[model samples]
Target: MTVAGEWIEKITGPFEDKKRYREYKARTKLLPESHRTAVEALDRYLMYFGSIGKSDVLLRMVDDLIDLFERAAADGTPVRDVVGEDPVEFAEEFLANYADGMWINKERDRLRRAVERAAGEESEKEGESPR
Candidate 1:
């Protein structure tokens, strides 16, 4: 999911739209207390990719998902704990839980598919070029 400001705006009605709410939350350093651990984990995970300061979308979505995971974890409802029926099911479940907002899942899936396609193409190219 893309975590559109619209959903946040709707979820937090009368406060402000999603954009304004993000600013408000950022200035106040306010996230559900439960999410502290997960959010911290997320921060560390993000560091591996580079500082969020370098990418606006990454900064926002990463921040938001961390907050969500933290909240869910605190509630004793961590997303990662959800069991899947099988490998494919588990992968889908994991991705869904990891993704935040509306188009986030779609984007993640697209990226995953692209990577897989690239790998397949590379194998085919190698196979055709070699004996």
Candidate 2:
């Protein structure tokens, strides 16, 4: 597995197993609130991981996460600014940051494809009738 695959797996795999998720949440709670952005993102990643339940998806996101941190650190993105704000805002900025990153274009494309696929399935189910 790639580094990205390993990262995503480490973050998401635990949560898939009942006992592991409990342990993960417990361990995560011990982390400072200042790390909330990263932690919350990790949590959400786990959620998405469960939703997709695909190892490839998790692998892609793992690479994306590393790139996001490196860029955030190099540009001096305040950790407090991300983690200390509203949850909604944090998610928006979090996704946008990844959307705008250079190293994870494939992951971004993967997300777009997923969204498009969902939309297409919904549209197909709705038939040819106009909205």
Candidate 3:
């Protein structure tokens, strides 16, 4: 598999597994109130794609959406401010940018490298060989 394919598979594995999905759903209850809505949104979005088995593109989109929310939250930005009045429109605009050839390939490469680097760091921490 290509690096992007490997990264997507790794990230989406839990969402694809029934047992993991149940565990993830249960764990959401423990998140802070501020983060709960974002988690729920991600869950619903994942489910929408899961039902259709359209995971390849879904994984990329979900990854981007999660990063966007995480950065916004970490920066203490209100969801309303980040997404504006119509979140659907905001998301559509965000996705449209990726539909452009230049942005899509650049973003994909960046995500792939980030995932690979994170995996390597994790393996190093555990004293295991990197993949």
Candidate 4:
């Protein structure tokens, strides 16, 4: 599903409004990849907390995050510094300010494992140990 559809499903439950979802999906596709990913992550974070209904706050937070990233990129901050070599740690740290539950703990472990697996695959492609 498109990020928009995924968000809509999260907010209103499955298959709530196909037309509006499609519209949002199309609009989302127009966003830059970085912006899209940030928005998606924010959506997932809010959904995990069952706060998707708070669209206004979520939107503002996502916008602020995107702005921060954009400014950092403009200032020549390395992507690794922004997202970290371990995306799970970075994600957990970033979400810590917004999240307050056991869900984040489990999600952090899952994210870490997924990032480590991806890094391992990349290392293999480069003929190096994951280390």
Best by lDDT: 3
In model 3, the runs with Cα more than 4 Å from the true position are 1-32, 42-53, 95-131
Q: Note the Cα lDDT for every prediction shown.
A: 0.49, 0.54, 0.59, 0.58
Query: Can you tell me which runs of candidate 2 are displaced by over 4 Å?
Result: 1-41, 48-50, 80-84, 88-131
Query: How does each model score on TM-score?
Result: 0.30, 0.34, 0.41, 0.39
Cα misplacement distance, residue 128 of candidate 2 (Å): 12
* TM-score, ranked from best to worst: 3, 4, 2, 1
lDDT of 1 by residue, 1-131 (tens): 34686686556553424465466346334544534544544455544433222233444555555555545655777444533235345434434443443354566689987785666764565565322
lDDT of candidate 2 over 8-90, digit per residue (tens)? 86886743454544544565555445443576576585455334344444445444544554455556776655445575565
Name the top TM-score candidate.
Answer: 3
Residue 7, model 4: Cα distance from true site in angstroms: 19
- Model 4: per-residue Cα lDDT over 1-131, one tens digit each: 99998897887755534454554556545556765565466447645643433344344445555666666556766656667677566655665555543444567788987886777965766788886
lDDT of 1 at 10: 55
Better of 3 and 4 by lDDT: 3
Count of backbone clashes, every candidate in sequence: 9, 0, 0, 0
For candidate 1, what is the lDDT?
0.49
Residue 26 of model 1 has an lDDT of 68
